[model samples]
Target chain A: MTLNDTDVRAVLHRATDHLSSPDGLVEGVRRGGRRRVARRRLLAGGLAVVTAASVAGVLQFSGTGDERIDVASPLFDEPTRGDLARDPAFLREVTDAWRGATENAELWLRGEPHVVWAGNTPKGKAAYVAQRSLDNPVVVQPEGERLIGYAGFVVPTANGLRVLTFEQFHDSGNLDGNSQAVLLGPDRDTLLVLDFGHPVEYSPSMSYAPDGRIVRQRLPVTFRDGAASLPVPPQLTKVTIAVGRAPMSVDSRIHVVNENEILFPDGKERPEPRRFDYVLPGADRAWGAAVAPTAWPPGAVAALAPFLDSIGTHVVDPEAPDLTVFGATPDGRRLLVSTIQYDDDPGHAVAMLGRGESEYPVVATQPVDWAEPLPVRLRLPDEQGTLVAAPEAKLEYRTGASGTWLDAGRGAALLPAGATDVRVTPASGVARTVRL
Target chain B: MRDVRGTEFDDFVRTRSVSLLRVAYLLTGDRHAAEDLLQEVLEQVYVRWRRVRTTPEAYARRALVNRAANRWRRRARRPESALGDLDPATPDATDDVALREAVVGALRAVPPRQRAAVVLRYLEDLSVAETAAALDCSEGAVKSHTARGLAKLREALAGSGLVVTIPNGSGSSR
Candidate 1:
């Protein structure tokens, strides 16, 4: 028999003529598209876990089999003026390095290099000065005496010069008196200290002092580059960060506060705080990048190494979570840290000090900035009959055994004697149970 | 002016869906499976509709052929159902109906890859290279599959009073 293309084409066409396009083809495609996306996401999540485990395993095994490895402190030993003057070799090295760096045209084209900080020796003479070269933008410490102590990174921004630094003035007997970290911003003529007169500890309450007068005191959450830098929200002004244990199973959440006002614990009306909660991957080997800041001073990484070493190993675990919140005072001067576990125990705060006392009291409770939001905020009455008002904010009040929630918009639906078993939920933010 | 991407896609589906469904039906050999294949292809096209709109038909047809090929690969382990059972309608007591049924039965017996090559090469009238691209293979494989598929059809339709001839060299068979 002779077989040709026409015979085959015509016959096949006639055979399949009864079949038609599916009625819900577009809808089916939409559903299939969703499933495909879910599959891709699951695959990507799996790959991230595998990569984290491989990295953790490599870090764990690459170390020497010793049960404990002491990571040497990166801070200078016995930072004093006498040590600076006596070290001719180090002094010569510092001078030559600065001279060579300045000679390069690439290091001074953008701006002139200036001495950001100068250390004082025992005899009240300048021991050494740390100058930042803007052309290349690096911290350079030039020679002088060795005994002096100075640690910080001076950053020049569009606003002005900001310094991340810690210094102890040796003039008086008050060791803690002069030991302060400051972040100086462009807003005011005076310096701003983030944790001034405060012990170097995990996630200290932030204080902003302009012209030596305290302007603001509040908690801030800071996240750094673990996989990638967690960028500062464009609208946020002050950021303070501390690492804490996971409040729940998921690693993070962003809580948007209501735009309206709410009564603070002090009975003064203030807008509720909006913040992001990031729970580091728990004890499980599954992981993401350990969070950290993208930009740090030349020596800041070295200074921070001891803090991380004191807490845990290179690998991060989800169940046994290890995290650190890196923040500065409003002025961006002092370094602040907060963590769940440090030095193999909870409630331990350590400031990296060259000499003198370093231990400080653990905060009685996790700072409000780092804690999860409560269900509600119901302030008791003041001396006058004015109930604390949250301007233009709606509140949901739940009363009695009926398990029903009733709207009490700006105190409109409440009884004069107050309702029993009332729970108040803000128009936004977490809710709280209120006693009438 | 509003965006025209959604309207353009709807127009293309309205105009070309029947032709696409026919190709899908021939490739899948089942009505339900043909609809599934067509929908799957449309979904993929919908995702990149902006980029594929200019050559939407070609893009969709390629996807349909490839997806059908994949389904066949997965279903390769299953035994082939009897061709007569595919459509139980007794031929409408006509000579042309019997011959058409005989051709369909013969085409069903061909393996999926060979069937795709045959439908693409003979029915849809794609070149050896186009068929190779649609099947994601070399031109040589397309040529070999087409030849073997036609030979199978010639044998299956020998006694059914239908003559099937595959032209040699570089000329159109018609």
Candidate 2:
């Protein structure tokens, strides 16, 4: 049976008619709103102080060019940690090693590096250092001392303490704080994630099968002095760091790191590139490069004005170059497509099809990376069949789950009338069957 | 003394929240995300209650659409695979479950702007001009987005073997 616009509206109503505003929604909004206002006020007050300081020239460099101003870091006030906390000689040696490692470093060190935590790991002796540096002047602010540090595992060899790996830590002012995880241990099986602000939980890296099934392994993270570490399970390719406790909210900060990239001590080798069934058409472009904007189609501009206007709301600079491409479905419907690439973040694309003179309806929008792009599916308005856009993949379709696969056109094809699924086999990878 | 503005805000929430939540549900395609998005928008509305009380529903809607768009952009930045773990949709069965799921899934695939236009125009039954006002774009743009959005919905439904008829005399007006 065919559905109509009225039927579609009925379906939407039926789908959402059961949803009611939860109790305490108003109270929650009020509470959150008050906090938001308070935060805004506090930020405004802080901005005033910074402005006043700038007006008074308090932020300007005050000393002569050759004079060195050494201010002790606040971290020095905090007591040290670990088994060698009271061992002055051991502390001195770690401090010396830090100084030597950073001696010729390009960072502007305003004060000496101090070892704040020295502990024994399964791998070897490890030390965490905190130093005063002017690497980020904005963060340094009125006090003029910004904390930049490094943590590493040290092993004693024939000569002396060999610094296995020293991972530098600095905040990019990301309000969420800075975190770095390194793989250590003799077999590189220990994962140490050092967070400067808050403790975080982690899950072993996940791998996605060709069929989009995810295999994830969870490991408990043990936290000690703002550092979380876990034993990396064998064949773990990556790790995902998440903040907060159980039942984490959707907005919780989560980061995925390829384990091979952080192989502590000797992190010089790069891992092999991951293979996917379908890669982006032009994945090699240097991010943030100037992309020539699609010359707006005069015929399609009126229909796309809202999309174009909405771009500014999503991107940092609406004036920056954006790339938009135009294509067509199997039914010869014109489609205007644009990839929403902003900054270094991965993005999705917008595709609107021209239908009946000036009506341009959106047909398909999907992510540009990570997810499988094979069996490129685009449904044409009014049952014109699904348009598959795999120029190099062999295509087959079936009318039912157990139906026989029938050969479909190459490059692109409209699914056969009443087809339920399509099998897409790329030039090299395994064939994937996508439900229509 | 009674806080008149607070009472008015409470009344607005009590009266209009159900409809607004439905819009949010269609926009985000996840119940939890929809609730979160609605509450966040309501908070913004409450903060600006004095200025927006005049047209609180419209303001709330505009805020919802924009917030949903921003949320989509943020979600897009994460690895696409990670998205499945965030607020998975709860299953709800109904007589029209297959058709509803197909329609909703298809709508979720549309771009944020186009989806907003469709939800506002088709689902909420807003006129082209009203949708344009809420989207803060030109009427012509509204026509284009709604048309394109509807076209996508139609195509997606058709591919799922559910043919949907376009509204009578419904085409983009030049």
Candidate 3:
């Protein structure tokens, strides 16, 4: 027999009691650890040798000129104090335009250099460029330390200055093999980045259509880069992503395409249906780069309406069913993670990608600032140390064992003086003046 | 070194399982069906926990409702006559217990989404907007489901010999 009012209230009380209890979650985590480890190993095993960033001291970056930029100050703000520090003013429309462009005049003039993050062999599926723009703007800060636009890219807006960054990482994890691990989000403290504002975990879901072709989702992430970094593209809004490729080495074919009515979870924009074929070859255990459309474009699968019926809707299954993980679930299923989800086991380097303490998803991959010539400077604390900057040929770092130099797309980061353990290596081996 | 995967996952399960189970019960109705529904949902949820943990409740809730509806749709293709045995086309006697059972059984007859709307609205005491959020349907769709579910419930309960009665004309508004 169902209980009366008092009993019903008791059950409700039992359910909600944990919300206020302190150790409830802590105890649950203690229970989930074993399976997570195995999943991590499994995911790691599938990964091709991810090339390490090169050790380079002096490298030059070429970029398009900042012709449209109204204010010309190489010295930008260096924000050190984290979120507690002042936020960098958003880049002007003119500055936002140059974020994506390489081979710019100022970049070449200032000797911009970056280490290629794609891969060593370079013949992989695609390249995801994670960059850091090291510049100095002269804007002053009130409660500011300096400004570091981590998750935020350069965007030109109405007022000419705006910076859109996650004040925090909302859903944080140090998954086994995904970019969102360190792709820290903004305003994570209160905002749940689940809906629209989260970063893309650089893992794609893949499944084979009955027609013996692989269907995949293309993901493009704008990392810390030049003045030309693009904001989240139009395609990724609302849609979840899965990536897969053809098993054989044969080139990818557009077997079936369909564009159907697209609706956002919040009903913001109306996107038409689209379906088409694109090239999707398996990654050849190397670094690669390719441009992909953000969302399944409307009108893509015009002719394949019948086949489209069996194919699942273009909904991104929110859960990462196949994580390709190394651990197992509590129920004894092998932990498999895919896409951006990874095992955030503590003390592991990968786990380092997760947000601190909060266990959120954002990890800071790049920390950069420039000299006084640039307005933005990563202010030096009272600690004693000797620092260094790029193009100072004295320091040399290489990508893996290969001889590749590192350089920024815009201006290179600056080196501070004193005894700090800052090191910069490059692909090129040469003697150059140390900018002290 | 101590396999943290399953244990950590179990921790997540322990924390979120009840909330999920409550939602499952609301969707499926009854303790037994809710248990089965929750087990299936949790298994599916477990697979994606690594990623979904970013927004676990959001992902799990959507999956739960979709899976439940998909299950019903598959059953729908079977002979419509199968339900005739359970469904009382005619009115019957109404005890409070009998009334609740009749309402619940009728809920099963409705589509999963619509049934979810009724349970969330009435049994669970959620608002129109809250039901929509949980069901992940348009607010208009929630209203239609609520209306249709209430009507079907009225017919089923009324057919149970009129022995047990629902307070007020439930079909009129809320």
Candidate 4:
């Protein structure tokens, strides 16, 4: 039995005998042609931007910085050319003109509008660049459709700006205009990014694009969560601002006590508070003793001990130290930790459970002003309990034999055995003891 | 400026899509992938309609070959998730269905370029010089690839007790 050309043809026909052109082949071709035309238009727009920039001579920078002030950007390898000392006015004029043009470039690529806004730090420069479609907030490019993706930076000299951060929706894959900060770097050409609020770094973690360009402009820069929206000075074409910090968290176990009560005991109801020690990763273990205040529950102290110890080492630096603290639930499930350091401007000194990491919030409240006091609520898995408090009041729980006042996390614990009442005091309002 | 209207392209598609789809299915073993490949090449033809219209079938075949090569390269770079579905040890020569399956599976086993060489030579009935021109390779390279491809197909299907015989003096014409 030999397989000849005729046999091969028979098998080939058998495999594809039922195949035919799709109903929309012509329409598909027309759509593809439109996309090709759009790509050509984008290429032309990019060339136009490059050409117009060269003619303006606005990008002139020494690509050199002060010997003491080291400057870096994730997208570019070398410093952009600049003559900062020679002509401040010329630099200023060119920076302003370029920024104005960039703000108005409004180049629509593949049906999406792209905009860039150059900013400045007192000592460096930065920019906030984004591509968005108001009609379609989702950035996921449809199959066979090319969506605009960028790999570039806002380069600024150290004498100009130092921090570069961008708002990126890491897990969502779409660049939604959320307060979530995706990429963060300080004086480094490439940024190490944390994806999806995880403590561990993401793969391909650095943003380093070779052909990154420097733009000078003052567009709308919105800084929330204590991030500074700085001005773009004349000396800098690019700018950098501090990246957003991820929230901190810890794991806790609790037993439900009827409708409004849950007890946090070593295992079950305890006459004493549960004790668990933890050393914050990336911080000095010894300093944990110095940092854990009596106002915090022993578990909160144990959770924050390492970070407090490491503060002495990071104190000299003006910026907040990036930290990750790990803890485990009573059942031993790994609890994710994200931290905002003491020096973080606009960030609080308190350590608290981040949203969506665990079932309960474990917070160690410092007397910092920025700690937004979350409302207190206690409930079992099924039923809601009746406990009332003033709107301005923060929740307080009883701790130790002396019943010392402790800041409470926004969660309920397991109800204690034979406990008739669970007392919750507000910061200023009267104490509310719910009868179980 | 090549302004070929939708009806002209549609007419051409309605007439030749089945033949083009068959060639694509032989090139890519999967039916859906073959349809996709044909649609993609047709879209390319639409963009360069004026130049492509002169030798539409040949241009479409060339585009299909290039696209398959690129897709194969990308797939090769991806990590292997499982042991391949084609088992080398289980080729049964007695079963006709198994032989057909072995033959079809063996086509995918050869390297993409060599497979294209084999398909153009035997399936499309193209001569050596024409296959060489289609593959953008020398005639000697085409002959070498065809011989190696046939030998590989024969070896792959040998476990099933299937024998592949090359036609004598075939694919020799200019």
Over A29-88, each residue of candidate 4 has an lDDT whose tens digit, in order, gives: 666654444333333222111100001111222322111111122112222222232344
Root-mean-square deviation (CA) per prediction = 27.0, 24.1, 29.0, 22.1
In model 3, how large is the Cα lDDT of residue A326?
20
Candidate lDDT (C-alpha), each: 0.40, 0.56, 0.33, 0.41
Query: Relative to the unseen true structure, what is the C-alpha lDDT of residue A45 in candidate 3, on a scale of 0 to 100?
Result: 25
Model 4 chain A worst lDDT window (10 residues): A252-261
Between 2 and 3, whose TM-score is larger? Answer: 2
Enumerate clash totals for all models, in the order shown: 48, 7, 170, 41
My TM-score estimates for the predictions, one after another, are: 0.35, 0.37, 0.29, 0.37
Q: Name the lDDT value of residue A144 in candidate 2.
A: 34
Q: For residues A245-270, what per-residue lDDT tens digits would candidate 3 score against the true structure?
A: 22211121111111111223332333
Evaluate residue A163 in candidate 3 and report its C-alpha lDDT on the 0 to 100 scale: 26
DockQ of 3: 0.03
Better of 1 and 4 by lDDT: 4
The per-model DockQ list reads 0.18, 0.19, 0.03, 0.19
Candidate 2 lDDT, A60-148, residue by residue in tens = 23354223333223243357766667778878888887666545232235455666666656655656665654333222232333224
lDDT of 1 by residue, A1-436 (tens): 3655566666766665655556765545644543333223223222111000000111111232112211111122222232234555544444444334334211211122223222321212122223321111111111110111222223333533233222211111122222122222232111112221122222322232221111222233322110011221221222232212222111321111110011121223333222222221220111113223355333444444433322111112122223232222122122223233321122222221111123322211221111222212222222111121222244444446565676655422212223454444455765655554
